[model samples]
Target: MSDKIPEGNRSARERLAQQRERDKGREKRRRTLIVSSAVVGVLALAAVVGLIAANVGKDGDDTASGPAITPSGATGEASLTLPVGASDAPSTLTIWEDFRCPVCAQFENAFRDTITELVEAGQLKVDYHLATIIDGNLGGKGSLRAANAAACAQDVGKFAPYHDVLFRNQPPEPDDAFAKNSRLIELAGEVKGLDTPEFRSCVEEGTHDSWVQKSDTAFREGGFQGTPTALLNGESIFPKKGDEQISVENLKKWVLEANKGKKPGTATPSAAPAS
Candidate 1:
């Protein structure tokens, strides 16, 4: 017998080897595709869960349980307004704001000085309406907690200074730093006489949580576009008023115009103490 295999047998052996190699490659590719698909499915599922969590309680389903503890000095409908400046000032600036809202922080930082000037001059009194829209929209309690802390400040007549401190030191939107009572209390130390045991207790206990929720409900029902809704003398003046864009000069002009013949307010009495 010849030592070498026949040529037809050799050809069959080579084809069999090549087919085995091809099958191995196909199996490898099939396994890779299955792993990729599973990873993609998991990521998509996580994204959906995150979205649902973010939107939790936004549908008016999560009402805060307990009596709504209205903050001291809160006026307006349903006791939702936190008034600053002289009560009888010639012009009234109504503002709807959320502590966790970046836009609200921006508005406050930009207009804080001007508003303070007008308020001191007795030309403008501001009605601040608090809302927790960020908590409902972004899945955090910063808005509610911060608003409650501010309300605590109101209890002691320190709302104005504490409000400024909060806006000046506002954290990034997603950080949720204000959600922590300790953080809120720490920030309170910046405001003179605001870091008291009572204030700390109010913040830690969420004394005004229900009130904050009610205010947010009012905002939702108010049909306004979003947070930092600024109205001067019952007319919206943020971003624009009538045909002119809002600027520092425009704001001064608007307040002056509104108070053209009106007398500046005298010193208004302090808010009645909480019962």
Candidate 2:
């Protein structure tokens, strides 16, 4: 009945109050810890996202790297000239090709013997304009590097045989394994004396990479579409009018007709009198 509670009762009430405060303190600490953990989780997730984005950006970079293909001034400044046949041959066959192109390989396989015959007989001059359109269209530097090595071979005067070996050892289109410098060097061994130290250095250094790049630019600017583009005296022979396809026989016929009875190795009347 007194205003103050009994001593034992007061002690029990005090203990209850202390226990309730302790429970409240524990709840507050639990909430604080949970919020801190959530914040840390969000930061970690953000860091992971940033790393993924950086990797994607690196993968998408398409900058042209490796080798500089030196433009051979043989056929103007824009072409890598592999002049087969007589210097004064009546007809000029200009070929723009990428080593990685399957059609180019087919074309080589179909007409390589004929090309060899004509080139050996000095009936025609072949100007090979190595282009890396495949690298641009399909991605990767395989075409570019292969073209560069071809140019390097040209430096040692072994371009013709080396070029043949390249086509012979060409890897399938998407598998650019053949483009590696080591493989290229191995292919060079097929051509006698092409595996010299100087030649190896050239291939490894990408000496002609710049030239390969320029050749591609020229190919684009020339407005001729696709690889293995065969031009007889500056005219396209592929993609004939209508549904007709260019055949090896027709290609020979076209060349013969273009020759107009002037045999290979003989100087044209316009250039010099036939003896």
Candidate 3:
């Protein structure tokens, strides 16, 4: 969390209230959670138009092109970046998302691994685009807190794990008390190397505001009227009916296709096992 977070934001009681609200009568818990808030499970970086250049889609596989590896050299054990891949790869991919958006979560659950496999195999790099699609709504306050906490986690190399857990047990939309700092800490505890006083302090600070705003601006200025927007290797891919799950199969298809028919550098990741 940023040092700029307002002091009134954190409260153990508030956290408990959030938890209670999440546990009982979920259906009765306003259905505001499903409201579209752009995208989910990403930490979007600000990109300037026209000058952004990427050589992505250079899959490790000989037939499929993965991401471009910048001549500037590799990221070198940079594991703590966003759930999205690091920035050193050849191409830059950006996803504009909101945490409360179910479709965004679907996209993450379906494709995060394919993207990771490629990144680990030295193929693709993804940049998360965080949008405050939840601001001003029921879960708005909580999402704001969570978003800020996410930034704090990012600072301590806990982003990806924190992100994964947040969604794994993510509560319904418009009901983000579950997404508050306390729960965020609860989620962080599930990941090794993530439980720390310093880390906790950072999360409490709400540092991701600047980062979240950048993506929010992108969503609005970038022309996204809805949540869950994705730009693969810099090319936008519309979600299937906006209700479509970004399963591993589909993510690979788009990633592979973005390479312009180039073979995947690694064995094509096993298709999304039928679920």
Using Cα atoms with residue i matched to residue i, what is each candidate's TM-score against the true structure? 0.77, 0.68, 0.58
Q: How does model 2 fare in lDDT?
A: 0.68
Per-model CA lDDT versus the true structure: 0.82, 0.68, 0.52
Model 3, 1-275: lDDT tens per residue? 67764556667667888988887758554443443222321212111110111112111111112332111111222221244443444444566556665656666776677777767754566655555555533324554456556656665555666777776766766576644678878877888877788767756654445444444444455655455666666566544423543445656665555555443343322221110
Candidate 2 off by > 4 Å: 1-73, 241-244, 266-275
Q: Residue by residue across 1-275, what tens digits does model 1's lDDT show?
A: 77999899999999999999999999999998787566445433433443343345565325468999999888899999999988889999999888877777767866799999999999999999987877777777888899999999999888889999999999987898998999999999999878878888999898888998898889877877666788998898765688876667789999999899999988785865642
Clashes of each: 0, 9, 38
Better of 2 and 3 by TM-score: 2
List all candidate RMSDs to the true structure: 17.9, 25.8, 21.3
The residue-level lDDT of candidate 1 at 94 comes to 96
Best by TM-score: 1
